[model samples]
Target: MKLVLEILTGVLFVVEVGEGCTVAGLKDAIAAQEELPRDRIIFVLEGDPGRTIRRGEDGVPIVELGFRHGSHVYLFLEPEEDNGDDP
Candidate 1:
């Protein structure tokens, strides 16, 4: 299945993975493709918290997590924290 990953900074990535791809696996793939650390790339499903996608769902398959083939995910890039708090 293919999914759209739209980074918070306006970068976009269309990734193709197996039906059993877990959230962690997807993040790793993106990290490898973008040459960034997996920990820095985060995916979040907006709206209600109950229905939102969280990092705790790492081991769950995206398909079973209600992610469609063309699901649009918001990828938040969390850079390392510094002495100064800046976005």
Candidate 2:
């Protein structure tokens, strides 16, 4: 199965994985392909807040999240928190 992912930076890429593949596996693949840090990436279903897939839920298979071949998903960077010390 091929999953199309659109990053926050407006970059789009396709990952070839099986339906049985876990979200964690996908994340690892994305990180390797983009040469990014896994901790900095987040995955969410396009236009669906309720379907946000967190790193903790990586064990869940892609099909379990309602994703099929050629599905399009959104990738965003984990937002950085603003500390009060920032002036």
Candidate 3:
């Protein structure tokens, strides 16, 4: 299945992956293709009340998430947390 990934930077990437690919697998693929860290990638379902797809969730396939060939998903980078080091 070919999935369309729209990064937060307004860049679109098309990746060919199996239908049974897990979210983590998709994340890894996106990370590799985009040369980014997997931990920094977040997938959001595009639509009303867009929800963040957690990478830790297992057993759920991309097909089950309504992702089909040419389906588009929003990819947002996980923001860095403040360490509270500022005075």
Each prediction's RMSD over C-alphas, in Å, is 3.9, 2.7, 2.2
Q: Candidate 3: misplaced stretches above 4 Å?
A: 84-87
Candidate 1 error regions (>4 Å):
46-52, 79-87
Candidate 3 accuracy as TM-score: 0.80
Candidate 1 local lDDT, residue 56: 76
Candidate 2: pairs in clash: none
Candidate 2 per-residue C-alpha lDDT over 1-87 given as tens digits, one digit per residue, 9 for 90 to 100:
998999878899998987689988888899899887777677778544447887688788888888888888988878776777977
Model 1: per-residue lDDT, tens digit, 1-87?
Answer: 988887777888888889889988988888888786787666765435524455577898877777778888788767676877677
Q: Choose the strongest candidate by TM-score.
A: 2
- The candidate, 1 or 2, that scores higher on TM-score is 2
Q: What is the C-alpha lDDT of each candidate?
A: 0.76, 0.82, 0.79
- Residue pairs that clash (backbone atoms under 3 angstroms), model 1: none
lDDT ranking, high to low? 2, 3, 1
Clashes of each: 0, 0, 0
Question: lDDT, candidate 3, residue 50?
Answer: 69
Best by lDDT: 2
| lDDT accuracy of residue 17 in candidate 1 | 86
State in Å the error of residue 38, model 2.
1.2
